[model samples]
Target: MPVTELTTDAEALTMTLIADVDAPVERLWRAFTDPRQLERFWGPPGWPATFTEFDFTVGGRARYHMTSPKGELSRGAWEFVRIDEPQSFEVLDTFVEADGTVFEGFPAMRMAYSFEPTETGSRLRNVTYFASHEALEQAVEMGAVEGSQLAMGQLDAVLHDLREYAQGKGTRTELLDDQHVRITRLIDGPQELVWRAHTEPALLEKWMLGPDGWRMSACEVDAVAGGRYRYAWEPLDPAAGTAFGFDGEVVLIEPIRRMVTTEHMTDTDYPSTLNDLSLYEEDGATLVTLLVEYPDRETRDAVLATGMTDGMEASYARLEGVLVSLPG
Candidate 1:
């Protein structure tokens, strides 16, 4: 029902599929970037796919195999050409062997995927172009149309489970641009609970430690526009003998929906940074996206090289446990 249209153009030697998904653009985009998520709905009905190799960057290659109910397997590969975040991307798709050998006898196709935000949710468009009319005809004869329809139809159910699983797992982080980085996670429980975990000092102290054996020894929060907050962490093993922290002011606040804050380190010479956090409710789960901006690309790269992303991931994993223990 979510698949609104599937059309083939003989003149252009292409097949286009349009689907209206119930999930947000970011969530749908994750289904494409995350190989494990893509494996779930990549094949038609009874034929499930397994990705043996996946590298989502531009010019990277992804190899996968689909297993039919009769135990037959179909192997393919995609050479990524362009990746435009949550909006669109293009790839060269071709049949391949398990060892990554291309099947030259089969026609290779170019595929483009676009995601557009709609009032209800998101509209996904996929177009596959062939080398010639004969190639297109061959694809159609090989059940490409039916297989695509069945595969796209599985997206709704896959998205439902993905959102549910993300509630406590699968937090992801990526570089958005030269000076911006984005981290996203689905928090279990409602938006208000996630908001408290982010803004309340006591809850923050429980999960915001940067590394193992480090504990937040002091935390103070004034959760309001123009309010100030401070957090200090010390090694749990007192013998480590080092303490570090950050203090900042809340620049903007929108209750449980959004917060913007400035952060200045107390233990380092790193330049101050701004963080914008936004929360959205999706089927009773809270999707949190944190965008961090730096003054310049050099500073951003320097901080990233310090393994901040790994620290954030560690902290987020702890946050999930804390969320699980909280009252829903």
Candidate 2:
């Protein structure tokens, strides 16, 4: 167990937990910031967490749910209040309903997390501030202390083998649920460049083309919240396959960090899929995680059957080449 201390003060209306881990401060920060690593230990044993949405910036909100052994779900959310990268952050943590609405009568808390370098590795201090003594007592009675300890106990293993998680994985896909799929690719570039490649028409036209013999015939991008984007592709020879394209409306944007959009086949009545794209950089490489939420399981399966991952891999490989050629 990494936890070194756990305390609750009724008069202070606060609960604090401290832990020391055998990982560098930067590594520890990544473990907390990356949703992939976070989900590995965010919940107690027998209750694993799945982050449906994670926006790691001030004023952004993260939504996740923990599943119990018997399939019951406990949903929660966090509105980021402050962030001082690699050092500390704070959030308004709240119990939420399935649709992300705050649960009525549930106690919400302000949680602050601070990370500092230690001689061996790093120390993490997490403090939860309650609204009142009654709220503090309620949290304690609800097993907050034990749950937190159990959750932190599992962090060491995650930090120990960080590289094995997603560093070299080309283009991997995870079926988060019947209606959701997560695809990840670690691009050999910075977050800003990758974001630009996705947003700039000139940059996007160069690499968004999936495979050889196909070119991006049209590339129109408006990458702001409520903006619309359109992309179309055609084969070099008209015999290979018919031309197709995708269009979407941006639902949310957080600059180079995150974007959420609704994607659908252009001119088709097919149901639209929600695509949540997040960028996280580590050791100068950016990880592109795209969470696609389909209207139903059938639709998700149908889309994946079209070799989506393979096509994405080809485009991503091209994207890396584009990034490398940039005058950095």
Candidate 3:
């Protein structure tokens, strides 16, 4: 119902469909990029598509098949031509056989998708260009317009489920004991990138800062065990004049797996704490668990009262963007 318009130009040999999705640009983009998400709404109503192979990069290929209620299989493939993050992408779409061969005499269309941000959500424009008027007419006769409309109509439900799943993965904090607290999150990226964000000084500065108007002034990391590390943050706004920092020593380092360290807040009265961070890969995502142990219950409670968990959650949210920007 949200599909705003569908148009065709026989002279230009193109078909265009525009839809406004009630989801952010990032969520809508993920629906097109993530293979699991793509499969859910790739075909028309009652004709669910199963993607056998999906690689969403420039020059990559995707192979899939849709099965109708009568048990007929419609195999299809796409060769990615260009991809521009959350903006647009172009691909060569073609009908194919089960053995990965293109269907003889079938028209191969060049498809382009553009996502634009609007006040309500994202506006998606899809255009398919045919080789000639004959090809365009052939596709139209095959119900391309109806099939595409049905597929795009299903995207709303997929986006809703993805949003709910993301909310469930938000930072979870638990009081393990009087002197220990554990914070865990299911991050979007892989373990390798998550580990790098934690151990690398440059990446660490991006999300380690506590709040707005604060900047990590200095960051140094010697990742090996027994190596020293220090980080300092200052208020960027001159009026909010305050500086605070922390220094630590790595007690253990396991690349892409775990790290243990001793940390002390330089400008606070709180006692030093031991931090144990563990990373695990689950279903292509990284789960990060951080345990902090203070010297005593009073110190732990004091730190908790400072709303540290809120800052951690905010910083972790920013880290998600950093992970998305990283090269694959």
Q: Which candidate is the best by lDDT?
A: 2
Tens digits of per-residue lDDT, candidate 3, 209-246, equal 87777899999999987899999889989689678788
Candidate structures ordered by lDDT, highest first:
2, 3, 1
lDDT of 2 by residue, 1-328 (tens): 7999999988888899999998899999998899988987798754568899999999999999986533468999999999999999999999999888899887789999999999999999999999998888888888899889878976865786434556677898877568878688888888899999889999999999998889999998889878999999999999999999999898877688777788889999999998878776766778787878889999999999999999999999999999998866
Worst 10 residues of 3 by lDDT: 160-169
lDDT of each: 0.82, 0.86, 0.82
Instruction: List runs of model 2 lying over 4 Å from the truth.
Output: 1-104, 108-164
Residue lDDT tens for model 1, 49-155 = 78988888999999999864334689999999999998999999999876789887887899999999999889999999999998998999999987787678657
Clash pairs detected, candidate 2: none
Model 1 / residue 143 / CA error / Å: 43
State which candidate has the highest TM-score: 2
For model 2, what is the C-alpha lDDT against the true structure? Answer: 0.86
* Residue 242, candidate 2: alpha-carbon lDDT: 91
lDDT for residue 120 in candidate 2, whole number 0-100: 93
